[model samples]
Target: MAPDDQPAPPLRRRGARMRSAVLAATVDVLAEHGLAGTTVGAVARAAGVHETSVYRGWRTRENLILEALAEQLDAAVPLPDTGRVRDDLVTYFGALARLLATPQGEALLRLSAERDDTLPDHRLAYWSDRLDRGAVMVARAVERGELPPDTDPGLVIEALAGPLFTRALISGAPLDATLAPRLVDLVLGGASAPKPGA
Candidate 1:
């Protein structure tokens, strides 16, 4: 048994490494090429893995792109906990605005808007999960009394995000640095304002 005859490492280790590489490469490719241009061959080449390996693991290009985009979005927009709801909202939405202004982020927004019968449910699920995760900030604010108990976290998040999406995906408006604070103030203003009866 010569040292050269030693078998390769186990499939688990190789698979894990390949998965990481593929996901990272997929994000880069998506950023560079957008959804229409991204392909398994491009991602595999970027990842230094065989196209068959990517297909075997992800089963489809849509799945691979969705997973990569989801991972990137989660990392890029984290919920801020500054102990003050206003500051938290400003920081969180500010990061989101910045991300949405980038080429990669714009590509993701366009990808989400595309009507793909194969990914309709999956895309909706992804956005629903993101809204839920973002709503935690408002939920915490309510628990801390920064916002009224009646505040709808999901609605608050949607209100803050809707305009940004429109600007990025529809009107092609600029996502400036000042926009997040302004939006946070507008949404939180109504949320924190005293009720008519109160």
Candidate 2:
């Protein structure tokens, strides 16, 4: 049996490792240099891989960077499950605030400001999932008799989240520890359903 005739081992392990490394490098570059700076060459150099490999695998630099950013957000953000709705919201949003305060978070915010059309449609779905999670919190509270039975969960979430985002992005205000609860309180202040006959 000639050596060339032997079966070749699978490249699965190496491929997975390289994929992880390349994605991490993309995130690091975006954090340090912003989206415009994370060229394929830059990421390949940072990841210690050949540029051709990245291009062959990811097809485009924009796709790779967006996937990398989405991976980070998916890993970091989770639905809150605490028994109390307000506490759950505060905790959930507090983590988001801290993340948004980082360089990577700031870079993502810049992406939002620039209105990059290259961003995939799935990213919007991710945000919608997050909003649904907030709705779940409101639904749970309603089930527990904490709020009115007919309360609009989406409205409840928007009221709770809008100010937090405003402070983090538009207003340039610090997301102080107390801000989460304050926002929750404001949202909960009118967390009731309209009268059935009204």
Candidate 3:
């Protein structure tokens, strides 16, 4: 039998729908009440599921929140893979900036940060996991001679995103499409430009 002749697999589509419902409801609860408001019972009510169902899938509110956050992140920003490091980074963080400006995104960050005093390790782990890939890409650019080998990728990421975040949250400025690419250009120039002696 040819591959095309094989029967279609079972949809199991309900799993996806249920997961999405939980995540969407979680986002709403987080936005309205912050992290403290997203209890298992609250999420269950919001998702139209029995409290038992939530416990069956996730034993605790923290676990549920983490899973929901991961799902939300998957939708908010796609890490760019363009050959140009600067362009790719700018585009990536630009998307992130836009997300941060949204109601859900802002609420998520604030809620996460609000818990930092109690769970500093969680904050470090979360950022380290999320940022590892981006750091690798910048490091690769340096290895390829596209950037200074000694440059700190962490610092590079901060430079690219710091201004945008500041502008959005602190200065009340826009992360307009035009401004994002321009910021990329400025950072890329600083990273790759020949030094005075070299």
| Best-matching candidate per TM-score | 1
User: What is the number of backbone collisions in each predicted candidate, taken in the order shown?
Assistant: 0, 0, 0
lDDT string for model 3 (156-188, tens) is 777776786677556878767777777677676
Task: List runs of model 3 lying over 4 Å from the truth.
Answer: 1-14, 116-119, 191-198
> Which residue pairs does candidate 2 place in steric collision?
none
**Error at 164, model 3, angstroms:** 3.3
lDDT for each candidate structure: 0.87, 0.75, 0.74
* Top-down TM-score ranking: 1, 3, 2
lDDT of 1 at 76: 92
Deviation of model 3 at 37, angstroms: 1.7
The RMSD of every model to the true structure, in order and in angstroms, is 5.5, 7.5, 7.2
Candidate ordering by lDDT (highest first): 1, 2, 3
Give candidate 1 regions above 4 Å deviation.
1-16, 191-198
Model 3 / residue 178 / CA error / Å: 3.1
Give the backbone clash total of model 3: 0
- lDDT for each residue of candidate 1 in 1-198, tens digit (9 for 90 to 100): 899996554343366777888999998898898777789999988887778888999999999999998988889998888999889889988999999999888888788888978778889999999989889999999999988899999999999999999999999889999998888877876657864335
TM-score, each model?
0.86, 0.77, 0.79
Model 2 lDDT tens row, 1-198: 899996443233258788888889998998898867889999988887788889888998877976787777657767778888877878877777777777787676556455567764655765676778768888998999988998999988887667766776788888777777766776776437443335
Clash count for candidate 2 is: 0
* Candidate 2 to truth, TM: 0.77
